[model samples]
Target: MTDIPPLPETLQFTADGLIPAIAQQFDTGEVLMMAWMNKNSLAETLATGRICYWSRSRRSLWRKGDTSGHIQKLIELRYDCDADSILVLVDQSGAACHEGTRSCFTRRLEIDGSISEAETAYPTKIDESARQ
Candidate 1:
């Protein structure tokens, strides 16, 4: 069995003592989104079993799935081999994007490198009406 990794002893937080965390879906293994996290937010997230983020624009901590009910149930938190990045795998509920998309990765890129937003991954939600 894969044991849960312990929080690193030499974790290198930024000058502001914050780190960026990338969240992905555990089942589909698709990358979902990225967010910032401070030490306090990290601690609280593990302690409370909730995915928390450091909101740079708001300069505060926010628990995912709090506002829009798009909560990420923590499946695992992983550290890169270099210990510089964190990956969070989760069972996400509702839309993962603030734009009300199921994932932030709703755009499709052609083999020729052209890009286009296919459509909303999520069909209904608050941001939907606002977008239309």
Candidate 2:
């Protein structure tokens, strides 16, 4: 069994009372997605062992995989040196993107500032059936 670390005290939230949280795959070290978390969501994430994010558009607590089944299980949580950002290590179950991709960062930028999509999409087909 491992000891649970205390939540950092110096977290610096943005003006809207949110902190940028980055979710990364624990085993593969792949960046999953970037989301915002308010104090309530952050505390809930720690307490529940599930990743919870504050949805700016919906203005509610968006528990990952709750709707789309792309859940992110919290493995570890870390804060940046400035305490303005958070890193969430997680065991991702399904595609982390709404576009049915493994990662939300599938787009790439070239030196000339051109964008390109990844050749291979993970989990194969894009599932848009979850959308209403």
Candidate 3:
């Protein structure tokens, strides 16, 4: 694997020292989730080749899928033109959402100012055999 480039010094972080990061499926182009990251978490993700995010509510570093076994392997890291946001291309092992779905973006905003849950073609369902 190629080494990740060093974090640019020109990155513009928020006043709270955080930046928004969006995770996308590397091959399929599915948007998984968006999270916050700080300098430390960003560095950790690069070094480990796994996605790491900052938990604002918990006030700590959150390694993706640490407890759920839904790890996100980093394929590439990118930054937007604004330098204030990041996009993480990853190979997701399982459900990226804590809700046990492949992605967190299941809700869609309709043009009529209504919100709807997108239909799931292959919803993640618990396999009873796996518990055996």
By how many angstroms RMSD does model 2 differ from the true structure?
9.5
Better of 2 and 3 by lDDT: 3
Candidate 2 overall Cα lDDT vs. reference? 0.86
**Can you tell me which runs of candidate 2 are displaced by over 4 Å?**
1-7, 119-132
Write down the lDDT that model 3 would get. 0.88
Candidate 3 stretches greater than 4 Å from native:
1-6, 119-132
Q: What TM-score would candidate 3 get against the native?
A: 0.83
In Å, residue 131's CA in model 1 sits off its true spot by: 36
Per-candidate total of colliding backbone pairs? 2, 0, 0
lDDT of 2 by residue, 66-123 (tens): 9998888899999999999999999999888988988898887654799888743233
Best by lDDT: 3
Model 1 residue 116 lDDT score: 76
RMSD of 3: 9.8
What tens-digit string does per-residue lDDT give for candidate 3 at 2-76?
354478998899999999999999988888899999998999899889899999999999999899999999999
